[model samples]
Target: MIREQLEKADAIEARIQEKKQDGAGPEELEMLRIEKARMLRPLTHPNANERVYLARRIDRPHLKDFIPNLFTDFLEMKGDHLYGDDHAILGGIAFFHGRAVSVVGHCKGHSAEENLACCFGMPRPEGYRKALRIMEEAEKFQRPILTFIDTPGAYPGKDAEEHGQGEAIARNLAAMSRLTVPVISIVTGEGNSGGALAIGVANRILMLEYAVYSVLSPEGFASILWKDASRAPEAAGKMHLTAEDLVEAGVVDEIVPEPLGGAQEDPGRLYASLDKAIQEALCSFDGMMPEEIRAQRWEKFRRIGNGE
Candidate 1:
């Protein structure tokens, strides 16, 4: 059904472009616009697999793209004190609507070279450590921590394991749980496994409309459950991983709505909505004591999966 709608939308779009090139008049353009909208109307109710496809689009905006529009004076911080810098995780300080905050996110690249540079947005032990370091700094300065999660999972490479990848992720979970400063985490894309959770523990958790958060990718889950990775679509349906599903499950505090067709289709509008959501979330913590903030975060996570 989604493919049929896409095809129809694409065909209408092509005709619209062709007409414009041929100096079509306003009436013709208006008619084309109506046709296009009609073709895309059904897309407003995409299924879980369709949402997954949109969430994983390579053109979808990543951390680097969002930071410029949502924050100011972005100064990137690098390197874990214990090891070299991991490009997969970008961490730093920025001012969100004039409020100083620490930001950390998984960053996938647009090009092949850039993907290699960032390890396809798969963090290693060092990457998790770097985020932990920045989070600690935010706590010390009483700055709110904002994390954008968009990773397949932590790097499962041999080197990453040898370097204590599991331990690094575990440390982050513990530290984030206890941090006194308010923490907000948003899953902008693929939020898979402990890699996503390393920076995900927070006072409030938000997810983009089409974004997905799950214990494992659909493919992985399919392989484990049915011994067939090709049944990923089936797994995705059963996983209950969509933003709306997570919200109902109490796994996410809010859903930041994306523009029609998803974030990649209209990033400017998506960014604007995201900025507003972030501001509102931050305002909710105003005047709260440090211990109160910590307690709230702790209780929030404790209630997950409990139908609370």
Candidate 2:
């Protein structure tokens, strides 16, 4: 099934090329190419497996791509007071459109060494606590909170467990629930399990059109339920975790549009679109009081599954 998704669009492209070579003039060929481009199927409404693959593509935009492009004056904050620093979850204060905002997100590195250092964006207990610190700082300073979710899950290694990963994530959920400032979270890539939700309790939850967010990774779900990771494609189809599905279900407040294939195809456009969405989200809470902001956030989560 993964192979099916990765199969090149070679045949379709070849057929189009054949038409262009059929003695057409330059102007005619130009028009024909334009028509072909218009008909090229977009991953905007991609199937689950395709969406998952797109979300996992190495070239797709992640927190690393976003920070420099969307935010200014980003000052990287480090460490949880109780434990060591975690590169897996990057959090700091940044200026977004002239206003200060606390930004936190999972970091999947672009290189081998970076990946090892970032633990493939699977945050440990320290990472969650670091995120909590940044989030709380946002509330104290009365700045909006912006978080990006893009991890398979939290680090499940022995050290993480020994350091109380569950407790750290739980504390984040509880603290985020009561934060006095506006919180907006976007799923830029994979959003799996409590690792995603730890920083995802937001007044507005937005997901990229091609990103996949689920309770578990498809491979994990397949291995657990069917005892075979190879059945991941099947598991993906059944998950219903795509942006369109979540938006329709009211789990996501907005679906940020990406390029035809994925964010890697046009990351600049992705940045522009995401910037606008964040601006609008921040503006939405312009005149609300601290308690009002917290109450609105609570009500948003409460309405998620009740058809309100």
- Per-residue lDDT of model 1, residues 202-306, tens digit only: 999989998999999999999999999999999999999999899999889999998666786579999999998999999999999999999999999889989
lDDT of 2 by residue, 1-308 (tens): 33232234334445557767786577865775555454445333678987899888766787988999999999999999987899999989999989999999999877778789899999999999999999988888899999999998999999999999999999999999999999999999999999999999999998999899989999999999999999999999999889988987788999999877677656899899999999998999999999999999899888887876
Q: Model 2, which residues run further than 4 Å from truth?
A: 1-44
Worst 10 residues of 1 by lDDT: 1-10
Residue 259, candidate 2: C-alpha displacement in angstroms:
0.5
- Against the true structure, whose lDDT is highest? 1
- TM-score list, all predictions: 0.93, 0.88
lDDT of each: 0.92, 0.88
As for candidate 2, its clashing pairs are none
Error of model 2, residue 197, in angstroms: 0.4
Return the number of clashes found in candidate 2.
0
- Superposition error at 247 for model 2 (Å): 1.3
